[model samples]
Target: MNASEGLWSHLTGGALFWLTLTLVVYTIVDRLSLLARRNPLANPVLHSVWVIGTILVVSGTPYETYFDGAYFIHFLLGPATVALALPLYENRRVVLRSLVPIVAALAVGSAATIGSVIVCAAIFDLPAMITISSLPKSATSGVAMGISQSVGGDASLTAIIVVATGIAGAVMATPLLNFLRITDRRARGFALGLAAHGVGTARAFQVHPLTGTFAGVGMSLNGLLTAVLVPLAASLIGG
Candidate 1:
């Protein structure tokens, strides 16, 4: 093989290459988002996914290979999710004052999100497994996957749906909220989190700290609720 081709193969075959590529791609897209004044279309996660997916496809790289290099980041996800609590703790007083509304919204929002998915699946005549898998789509991936498996759905499909839901929510939330003329940051963030999960919470943080805090609260509570609700709903439906 030629010297350049040999070097390329050597680099691409290593774990460090994929890890570096993931970080660099994300950083570049994040900077572009900032340069674009944080436009929703310039969302870093969306762009990163596009760019990285393109590269993997073009290079004929297996996802498992890419993930091997990037597994450390996956390992850190649990800790990162836990760190979301710090913001909630700092804003405890404000959150506590809105406890009643938060609880009410969580119940209504969780049910609506899950119910809508189930209804849509039924309307489309989708398999029962698909409906069960999608029931926890609004929850974060880890929790969503567990709920999906416990309820006899495909965990991998649930993870994919959870990610798609989050990305769609993160991208459309600002525009949707503005179109509705909803000026309340807390409301916006909570809705985003409840509907979108981690990606939505990240988008909320980009807009405002208060919004991010509420979004985190919503995401956390929704995760817990989905765990219980999905199993109960599955039983009710005889799934």
Candidate 2:
């Protein structure tokens, strides 16, 4: 093989290559997002997904191969999620003060999200599996997947739907909040996290620390609530 071809093959054969590529792509996209003044439309995760997806497709790399190299990053997700507790703890006073409203919002938001999915699925006559899979779409992917499986839904499909839901929520949140003239950061962050999960929490962090903390609170609480609610909702919907 030619030197260039040899080098390319060597690079793709190792775990470091995919891991580095993922990090570099995310870093570059994140920098671009900053350059864009942190515009909601310039969401780093959304753009990074597109870029990495295109690269994988163009290079004809199988997802299993890429994931083999990038699994370390996936492993970090657990720690990263746990780390959210730091912010929540740091803002304990604010969070405690808002406990009543937070609980109220979580209940209403979780119900609305699941109920709407069921209603739309029934209206469109979607399959039982698809409807059940969608019930946890508003939760974080790992939690959502478990909820989907427990409810006899497709876990993999639930992950995809969760990501889609998060991206859509992140992209729309800022503009929608601005349109509504909702100036309260707490409300905005909580709403974003409730609807969008982790992606929305990340977006909230970009705006303000307090916002991020509240978003994290919203996301965590919603996950727990969804875990309990989805199965009951699934049974009612005949999942």
Q: Give the count of colliding residue pairs in each prediction.
A: 0, 0
The stretch of ten residues in a row with the least summed lDDT in candidate 1 is 72-81
User: How far is 33's C-alpha from truth in model 2 (Å)?
Assistant: 0.3
lDDT of each: 0.91, 0.90
lDDT comparing candidate 1 with the true structure: 0.91
| C-alpha RMSD in Å of predicted model 2 compared with the true structure | 1.5
- List TM-scores for all candidates, in order: 0.94, 0.94
Model 2 C-alpha lDDT per residue in residues 23-124, reported as the tens digit of each score: 999999999999999998999989988899899999988888888888898777667778889999999999999999999999999999999998899899
Off by over 4 Å in 1: none
lDDT of 1 by residue, 1-239 (tens): 99999998998888999999999999999999999988888888889988999999999988889888988776775677789889999999999999998999999999999888878987999988788889999999888888899988999899889988999999999989999999999899999999999999998999999999999999999999989888888888773
Assess the local accuracy of residue 98 in candidate 1 as a C-alpha lDDT between 0 and 100: 91
Candidate 2 structure, TM-score to reference: 0.94
Q: Give me the overall lDDT of model 2.
A: 0.90
RMSD of each: 1.5, 1.5
